[model samples]
Target chain A: MDSRKKEGQMKTNDILEKKSTRRSFMKKLSIAAAAGSAGLVTGGCVGGSGSTEEMGLKWEEYFKKNYRMMTDKEKDETVARLEKLAKLQDDANIQMSNQEPREKVLFGYAFNISRCKGYMDCVEACVQENNLDRNSKTQYIRIFEMDSGQQDPTSGDGKYHHEVPVENKYYMGIQCFHCENAPCIKACPTKATWREPDGIVVVDYDWCIGCRYCMAACPFWGRRFNWGEPEVPKEELNPKQHYLGNRKRMKGVMEKCTFCVQRTRQGKLPACAEACPTGSRVFGNLLDPDSEIRYVLKHKKVFRFKEELGTDPKFWYFMD
Target chain B: MKKIFLRSGLFCLCFVPGAVFLAGLPAMASGGGVMERIHHAEEPYDSMAIETAYQQPVKTVRAKESWQGGTFRVLTRKDSITRFRCSVCHTDKKVLVKDGALFTHDDIVMNHGKGENGLVCIQCHDEDNRDFLSDSSGKKIDFDHSYQLCGQCHFRQKRDWLGGAHGKRDAYWAGERVVRNCTSCHSPHSPAFKTKMPETYSLPLDQ
Candidate 1:
C-alpha cells in the first residue's frame, strides 16, 4: 500500500512539472516573440535585411516540422517556398508531388540469375529515368559479372567493360533491396530517415543534417552520399519527380532507390526492369500472392544475397 | 549544419518544371501527329493504372523448329521474304520443283541439325503446303503460330517460358501481360544469345 501511494505521488509530481513548464512557455512566448521581432525591426530600420518578408520566409523554412509530422497547411507553405526557390535558382517550374502508398500494395523484386548477361542496360536506363547526377558519376544499378561456377557477390566485378556473355560466366545486378528491417533508418540520429508505407526506405533531404551515420549502417552499400554539389546538365534533368524521391537532390544529403516511387506508384514498371533486354529482373506486389514474384519464389530455387543477416529483404535471385 | 535543403528543393522545382515545359513546347509544336508518339510515351503509366483482369502470367503452347539452308536469321512473323504462295507453284502432280537442283531458297544455309540431328526441310515444313508448318505428327500449323513448331523438341524450355520463368514480360507491369515471341530474341537457326558490349553511361576507367 505504501509503495503504490509513493508511485501515485511521483506520477502526479511528474505531471505537475510538465504542466508548470508548458504554462511558463505559454506565458513568456508572446513577450519574447515581440521583443525579438522589435529588436529585428529596429536593427533593420538601422540597416538590416532590406526585406523583412524574405527574413520571415527563411525563419519559417528553418523552423518547419519533420516531413511526416507537418500539418496540411505547413505542407502547402513549404511546397510553395520550394517552388518559388526552384524558379528563382534554376528558372525551372517543376512539380514535386507527395504520393501516398497504395493500399495492400507492398513492392518486391526478383532477378533471374540465368538470364542476366551483364549487359548493363538496366543501369543506363535507371540513370536516364531517375535523372541521377551526371557529373558525380552516380549510378544506382550495377551489374556484376561473376566467373564460371561462381554465384558469390563479393567475387563479382561491376566495373568489367569487356565483351559480355563471357564463356561459362553469369551476371547479376544490385540496387536498394528495401529491407523490412532497414538498418539505415535506425542509424539516423535525427528522425530524417524512415520507411514509407510501401516499405521503401526514404530520407527527408530537407530535414537531414548530413551526419553520414546512415551510410555507415547500411550493409548492402545501398545509400550514396553527395560529396560534391551534384551537377546535372539542364537538358538531362527529368521533370517528373516525387517529393520523397528523384527530385533534384541537394549536396551533403543521402539518397537511395525508392523503387521508382513516382513511376511505380502510378503503376509503371521501374526503368531498370523495363530496359532489361533479357528480362532478368522481375518486379511485382508482394501482397498479391498471384504476382510473378511469388511464382518465382514458390516454383524456383530463389535466394537473397544476405538472408543469414535477417534483414528480410524483399528482393530475390534465382537461377534455372 | 544550419544548411538549407528546401532552398535547394525550391531551386530544383523552379528549374525542372521550366525545363520540362520547354521540352513539351517542341513536342507540342511538331507536325504530322507527334501527339500519338507522346501518347504512346504515357501509355505504360495509363495502361498499368487501368483496372483490368489480373491474369496470372504464363500460357503454354507447343514449340517447333525447322531447318533453313542459309545464315542464322530469326524468322520473323512478317514473312516478307516469301516470294510465292503455296498455290503459286504446288499443284496436283507430286513433282519436285526444278528437278530438285537448287531451284529455290538459294540463300538458306543450314548450320543446325547435323548427323543424327540432320533434318530435311520438309521434316518441319509442310511437304505439300509452303505456308503451313508441320509438327512430328504432320499437324498443319499456321505460320503465324510457329512457336508451336519450335516446342516439339524444346518441350522443357517451352514449359519454362510458359511459366513466366524463362522469358521477358512487357514494360507495363500490371494489366495485360504480353510476352515476346521466341524468335524475337533468338535466331531460329543459331538459338544462342550473341555476345555484345555492355551499355555504358560513362566509363570509370579509360580502358
Candidate 2:
C-alpha cells in the first residue's frame, strides 16, 4: 500500500514537472501544420508522375509496414496490390502466397555424393519451378565435377560440358544450405533477409535496399543479385509463387533458395529433390526422428560442407 | 480516462468517415470496368497440408522387418510392371532351356552380375512357379516382395532402403510414409546408370 501511494505521487510529480503551457502547445501545433502542408505540396507533385491508381498503390506500398510487423489484413492488402500490379505490368495471372510456417517442422536436406552423377536435372527443374530470369542465367543449384580423391568442392570444375560421371570424377551439388546461424541475416542493413521458423532462410525483396551486404557476408556465394530488370518469358512464368520465395523480383534485390517454399510449405519436396532421377536428394522435417534425413544422419557416414564455420547448415552430404 | 475516451471517440467520428470516403473514391471515379478485383478467398490453415498432394493410389506393403522400432510401408512392384502375370505364358511344367536365342525378352540385356561366375535367369526366377521369384534357398517370394530376393546379396542397400536412407519416397514428407521399391529404379537385368550429358549447365564464371 505504501509503495502504491509512493508510485502515484511520483507519477503526479513527473506530470507536474513537464506540464506544457497553452502558448507552447499552440507553437508546436503551428510548426506541425507548417511541416504537414509542406509535405502535402511535395507529395502532390510526386503523385503527378503516375496514373491515379498507380499513385495510390505506390503510396500504400511505400507506407506498408514490414512483413513481420503486418497484421493478417495488411498482408492480404499487400498481396492484393502486388497481384494487381503484376496483372497490369505483364498481363499474367500470378498467385502470390503469404503462407505461415508450419508447426513442428524444420526442413533438412541430404545429398548422396555417390549417387549424384552431375545430371543437372535438378538445376533445370529449379529454373522452371522458380521462374528464374533466363537472360541472367540464374541457377540456384550447381553441380561441381570433382576428382574422386579431392576433398574440397571449389577446386573442381562446375562448367564441364562433356558427358557426366567421368572416370575418376565425382559430383558435388551445392545451393543455399539455409544455415542455422545465418551470417547473411546479420549482414543485412535492413532486416530484409531472415531465417523462417521452419529453418528456411528467406528474403523480402520489397524491403531489401540492394546494398549487397548479405551477398558479401555469405560464405558459400548462395545469394544472387539482379543487376537489371529480371525477365521471365511470359509463357514460362510459374503462376504459383510465394511472396518470399519465387515471386517476381525487380532489379537490385537479392534472392536465394527458400527450399521451394511454395511447394515445401504445402508438404511437397523441393523441385530439385523431386527432379533428381538417382534418388540422391532427400528432404524431410529435421524434428521428426523417423524422417529420411534423420536416417541418413544416423546410419550413413555423412558430413556437412563446412562444419567448422559453425554455420550449422541443414544440408548434409554422404556417399553410398 | 473518461476524457481520453471521449477525445478518442471524437477523433474517430471526425477521421474515420473521411478515410473511408477517400478509400472508396478511386473505385467510383475509375468506373466498374477498369480492373476486376481478384477475390482470394481465405482458406483455413491446414496443419498437415498433405491431402491435396497425396494423390497417388498407392498399393503399399508393410516391411517384413522394422528399421528402427517403427514399421514402414513400401510401394508394391507388380502393378506398374508392363508385362506382369508371367503365368500367362510359362504355364507348362517344363524345365526352361538355358537361353542362347532371343524370344520374349529381347530388350533385356541380362547384364547384371556379368563379371565372374555370371548369373542366369533361373537362379532368381522359379521355373516351377513362373510368377514368383526365389531366393538361393528356393523359398518362394512374391513379385511384390522382390526386395527379399535382392537382399540376399545386397543386404546393406536393402537395410538402407528400409531405413529411408537410400530410396525415393512419396511426394509428401508428412503423411503415410510410402517409399519406392528397388526395382522401380533399377532394372532387374542391369542396375547401373550409364554415362550421359547433364541436362543443363549455366556456369556463370565460364561464360
Candidate 3:
C-alpha cells in the first residue's frame, strides 16, 4: 500500500509539470499575437492601407477641407495623400487625378412623363455610365410610378422593374432638378455647390467641406451623401473623367445628378435621354424655338416642376 | 412461402390496372374524340387553295377626301373595278344610301379600286352577296367590330393593332385618365386629319 501511494504521488507530480509547461507556452503565443496586431495597426496595413496623413484625420476634418482654399502645391500633396488612402481602402492600386480641372457646362433636362414607359433602362444606364460604388448606396435617378389618378406628382416613384410595358402605371423620373435659385448653393458657405451660366448646378469636390447643409436645402431630395469612400473596380472606372460629372468622389461628400454634363457639353445628349426606348424625353436648348422641345411646348400642353416654389427648375413635363 | 405468394398476388393486382392504363395510350394518341373530329372537319378552310380562291376576286381600294367650305368631296379612285370589293368583307346593312342611284354611282366612281380585288361596292353590297356574314351586336349585323369593319381593307393596320404597335388611349392627367376611341380621331367616309380641340377650348391663361 505504501509503494502504491508513492507511485500515485509520482504520477501526480508528472501531470502537474506537464500542465505548467503547456500554460506557459499558451501565454507566450497570446503575447506574440497581440504584438503582431499592434504592428499591423501602426504600420498602416490594417483594414485599409491609407496614408498616415489621411489615416490620422478625424471624420469631421475629412469633411471640412476645401480643395479650392488650398494652394496649388497643397492641392497636389492632398491629392497624392487621397490617392494613397484610396489604394489602401481598396487594396488595389487606383489611379486618381487631382490635377484634372472640373469641366463646367450649361445643361438642362426635360421629361415628358406622359411618354415614359417605366422601363428603368435610364436608371440602369446611369449606374453603368457612372462607376458608382455598388455597395455605397448612390443613385442619380429615382423613378416613381404613382397610381394613375393621384393628383400629387410626388406620389410617382421610379424604383421598380417587371414585365415590359406595364399598364395602368404612369412613370415620373426624378433627378437633380438644377434650380435657378438653388437653396443648396445658398446653404454651402464655402461656395462648393454653385450655379453656372448655362443654368447647371456644380459641385467643387475639393472645396466641399462635407457640410450636409446642401443636402437638407435641396427640396426635391435630389442630393446623395457618400458615407464611405466610393469603391469602384479599375475596369469599371470611367477613365475619361470630368470635373462636373462622372468624377469618382470620396466619402462624406454630397453628389447629385449633373444632367450628364460631361456628355452633354461635348454636343451629345444625356445618358438617360439616349437610353429611353420611346422618345419620351426631349432634350434641346430651351433658347432654341425650332428645337423639338420648343415644338412640344408650343403645340402640346406643358408645365414645369414645382413652379409654385419659384425655384424656376429647367425640367418640364407634357402629355402626348 | 405463403407470405411471398400473397405479396406477388398483390403486385399483380397493381400491375393489372397500370397495364390497362398503358394499353389505352394508343387510343388516346389516335385522338378519337369530338374535338379531334371538329378540328379535322375544319380542313377545307385551312387549305391554301381555298384561301387563294377566296382572295382572287376580292378588290383592293384606297380613297381620300378633302374638305372645302364646311363640305367634303371625294378626291379620286386609285383603282377601279366593279366586283367583290370592300363590301365583300363588310355588309351594307346600315347603308347611308339616301339617294341610292347617286350614292352607288359616287361610291363606285370614288372607291371602286378601294376594295380587295378591284370590285365595286355594288358587286358584293347587293342583296345576293351574303356569304361574308359577320357576328355583330346590332339587329342587322352590319360589321363584326368597329376595328374589324375597317380591317377588311386596312389589313396592315389591323395587323399592327394585334401586334400592339398602334392603339388609342385617353389623355391622362395627374389623377384623371380618359381614353378616346379611333373614330374620335378619324372620319370613316372622309379620311381627313381632324384638329383636336378640347371639349372646353379656352385660350391660354397667360394669353
Judged by DockQ, which candidate is best? 2
For the predicted complex of model 2, DockQ is 0.20
DockQ of each: 0.13, 0.20, 0.01
lDDT digits (tens) for residues A1-320 of candidate 1 = 23323433543443355566556775696577777877766777688544565566655766566677666777777777766656656777777667677755567888998889888888888887777877777887767777867766667777777888887888877788887656777688766887665657787888788898887887777777787778777777777777778877888988878888877776667889878878788887665555566567667888888777656577889978
| lDDT, candidate 2, A190-242, per-residue tens | 67888776778999888899999988888777888888888899999999999
CAPRI-style grade of the A/B interface in model 1? incorrect
Residue A278, candidate 2: C-alpha displacement in angstroms: 1.0
Positional deviation of residue A22's Cα in model 3 after best superposition, in angstroms: 66
**Which wins on lDDT, candidate 1 or candidate 2?**
2
The residue-by-residue lDDT of candidate 2 on B1-207, one tens digit each, is: 999999999999999999989986643332121011101112222324566456656787876767556566677888886777888766555544664243357777787885885678898999788789999999998888788999999999998898777878866666666777888778887878877998987474322
- lDDT tens per residue, model 1, B135-185: 999999776566688778877766666656666655555655455567656
Selected candidate, larger TM-score, 1 vs 3: 1
Candidates in order: C-alpha RMSD to true structure: 17.6, 16.6, 30.0
- By DockQ, the candidates rank as 2, 1, 3
Off by over 4 Å in 3: A1-106, A151-153, A157-161, B1-207
